[model samples]
Target: MAFTICYAGFRSGFFTIDHIHTVKQLIEKCHEYNRPLAVTFIDYEKVFDSIEHWAVFHALYHYDLDSLVENFNDLQRTLQQLYDACMWVGLKMNMSKTKVMANIYNVTNPSATVGSEMLEIVDLKTRLYNQCVLPTMTWTLTQEAVYRMRVAQRTMERVMLGIKLIDRVTNDQIRSRTKVKDVGNRITKLNWS
Candidate 1:
């Protein structure tokens, strides 16, 4: 089933190691199709350190683009309003390093960034990828696409562990209960229930 989490708290924020699973699934699919896949890593370090007031306010109020455009003033006014809001809240956006691009976007799959400039833009699927990569660093918010492949890998590991445990337990139970005259009969009775 598809999962949708509308709202959540800070401590239990939805970020998890789901990307690791998706990467595995993608690799498997590539092998099946005999296709090549390219992967790249990008970094945004200490972004919050340089946030100017305007950027924070812009992000806060201008969440949805189509809706925000209705109230769109010139960039100067919009940035000013954002700055005002930041002053009120003591927050800022690092203008110099705040990277915005047509194709490059923060997604849930933080590790695997997908951007095909030549390809027509498909529907964007975004998930939050927040993390405190270092103990001293602050938590950062990011969004990315869900990686199906990582999920497949995790699912496989769980299934394999379960099978192994069942086998070991079943063997032990059979050996321990060998004295029972009707072992198969007892097992059949348990199965039906």
Candidate 2:
């Protein structure tokens, strides 16, 4: 099920809040029952906004399903079917961006593939923090902290480039040679995003 903001009509309902509440309730139920829950969040890279509205509805209607698979093989098959369906509708899935997350209790190392590339597996909480929380927190860094980060990054870059402090290379020269963005600028871009 999907809950989206109603942009064209009356905006009385808090759909985003309701969606979060529903997810929270599902998590609580899973915890209470001591059952493992695996969730896959698919990023479409603005596929809906780029496509015709009716095409979006047609794609959804063609691939709608609500069921749980019994094993990783079944999951792989299901993902293959999904990939085929998306390709049939002229949508491409970026396999590199796809990730599979499972709880610690899950013994099998979950393996899934779309076409020939294997999807990466990541720890759920770590991925959530890295993707959701860390970017926001980066904006709050003090000047000193940012300076330290830049110093560390420059040191690493210098090491990779076989340069040393005694080499008499200027910071601007090193940066021009390395072609990497400054830590502060990267953080600013992250905050804006």
User: Cα lDDT of all candidates, in order?
Assistant: 0.33, 0.62
Error of 2 at 52 (Å): 2.0
What are the per-model numbers of colliding residue pairs?
17, 0
Give the lDDT of residue 95 in candidate 1.
Answer: 44
Model 2 earns a TM-score of 0.51
Cα deviation in Å at residue 25, candidate 1? 1.3
| Candidate 1 local Cα displacement, residue 140, angstroms | 49
Per-residue lDDT of 50 in model 1: 54
* Model 2 lDDT tens row, 76-104: 77777777766677777767677766553
Candidate 2: residue pairs that collide: none
| The candidate that achieves the highest TM-score relative to the unseen native structure | 2
Output the worst ten-in-a-row residue range by lDDT, candidate 1.
123-132
All-Cα superposition RMSD per candidate: 21.9, 12.7
